[model samples]
Target chain A: MDISAVNALPYEDFVNIFGNVVEKCPLVSAAVWTRRPFVSLADLEAAINQFIDALPESGKEGILRCHPDLAGRDLHRGALTRESRQEQAGAGLDALRSDEASRVSRLNEEYKRRFGFPFVVCARAHDKASILRELSERCGNERAAERARGIQEVKKICRLRLQDLVRSDNKL
Target chain B: MDISAVNALPYEDFVNIFGNVVEKCPLVSAAVWTRRPFVSLADLEAAINQFIDALPESGKEGILRCHPDLAGRDLHRGALTRESRQEQAGAGLDALRSDEASRVSRLNEEYKRRFGFPFVVCARAHDKASILRELSERCGNERAAERARGIQEVKKICRLRLQDLVRSDNKL
Candidate 1:
């Protein structure tokens, strides 16, 4: 789809296509729809990034909390959202050996316990080994820094999702 | 768990146990944790209800949108959150015949197109037959009334989930 196709969507259509761009937070897309008629795909993305960046601490935490734990229950049970399933599989999370899975699970819990939100990374950007490494390192970060890091990862995930839906190379 | 147990919980534990009481909106639990030390289970529930009740229209719609459509893709894919999976099973949504499933999918799409959110009902409280009936009827409701109705059903689902977690009759 091109920017014109995106710009032409009704509110519901816009939301249906873009709602889960920010993980499970459709409210982001709903809010973004109000600022429509994007000059380019980048403008639309900036709108989303601005909305996320403008959120208060609790709101950002809420967005993070909405995310499923990496290689956790949902993935094991075949219950991941379509985007999440693909991303996790892309990172080889779906094929983790039992030992690796257990280690990831433990680190995920420890991360959440420390940060009050799951350790979120753009899974498609890293394999299981790298994900585990980052999860371990980030667990030691200050809460404020970790929170900032997680939100930035969310935006990375969003940019990829947006690219999947809209042809970024197409001129407005 | 009793009210005393609930009040005694650390914030992370509290959220872990009650975070999903409102379906996918852990933010409710996260926010409610700040107002802790409940006098009783009822008081905790009231805290949750009031937080939901106080949301602006967009917030309410976002909450509804978080819910999966009855007998929809998540159910078919075995991807529902555990709470949702059980509630849907209790309502016989898992056993829908092909025709019933198709009807539901069509109605769900139509409903979303019309209302900007999915059709939400407290599945544990209704069998598939009654759910279809309600879905058919509510499809015609004015947007404001339907939004209010969906939120109320969310509360009903919350109440049941709370009952599952904290015994309603146990004295504080």
Candidate 2:
């Protein structure tokens, strides 16, 4: 669609298009919806902040739903590029080595026990070691703070994904 | 790892970590890597040119690889998220809509006849219509320019994916 046509879309239509993108990925939806019709990319970002502020309790749950179980297989959806999946899964499994896996298992249990959800992390960017370190560290956060942090992280992932998606489409 | 440990790593290490993230998504890496080793989050962004200059060619290719084919089902090896393969495949098939399909088939045959590889795009971010638009638009470009542009777009994608990965991992 023309950039001008995109500009002409009613707020609801814009929302609808954006909403379609985000709906499959609630974390993305929350992040994108957090920002509406962006006059400039900067404005779009500010909207992300506003959207995060407006998040409902249920929205938090929705964000959590997109995450795969920690160290669990079948976490990803499709044929992830060979290198990306190898890196993420290798890092996750490495973090869970021998006793570490048990510890992670216990932590996963505790995390779910406390927050009523799986421990979610956007695993795309992390290395095997760094991810392991994070898995161990975040296991210590108090429930409320961790939950809030998780939602925020999801929001960040969504924003990045949106930008990536748009840029790809625009080939800009 | 402790924040200090992260800080302690050589800049190359940081680049390596950052490189992995961008391998699948370049545009994000391009936007965010503009900022470096932020002492305070306040001191984050600087300029894009320097950071881009600092990146290796393989790093650039890694970013380019994150995108899905324009009409193919495979996600780039560097792709971080679980893109729906079923969805992408269905969409690819859909793009071959009778008239367009024949044209695409003819183009696919002609293009492959001329070039040794399949046409590629980061399809997850695009809808059928926009992709079709791009396919037709790109058909007119000179072979060398199209290859160059295609490679460049891939790099941008890798950068974006890398940034997204880093942001997610940092929070974890």
Best candidate per lDDT, number? Answer: 1
Which lDDT tens digits does candidate 1 get at residues B7-62?
Answer: 88756567678878987777777667656688987898898888777655667776
TM-score of chain B of each: 0.95, 0.48
Local distance difference test scores for all models:
0.83, 0.47
Cα-based lDDT at residue B15, candidate 1: 69
The 10-residue segment of model 1 chain B with minimum total lDDT is B163-172
TM-score of chain A of each: 0.95, 0.63
Estimate the TM-score of every prediction: 0.64, 0.38
TM-score of 2: 0.38
C-alpha lDDT (0 to 100) for residue A25 of candidate 2:
31
List model 2 lDDT by residue over A1-172, tens digit each: 4344445543324433443222233223323432334576545555544554554443344335334455653333543333224435755653456776666667766666566545666565565566567766887888778778877665565565555545554522
Clashing pairs in 1: none
Please give, for residues B36-149, the per-residue lDDT of candidate 2 as tens digits. Answer: 445632222223323333434322222233333444323323332343344355456433667765666676545534532335555555777776777777777776565556
The residue-by-residue lDDT of candidate 1 on A39-76, one tens digit each, is 88899999888877765566677678778889988888
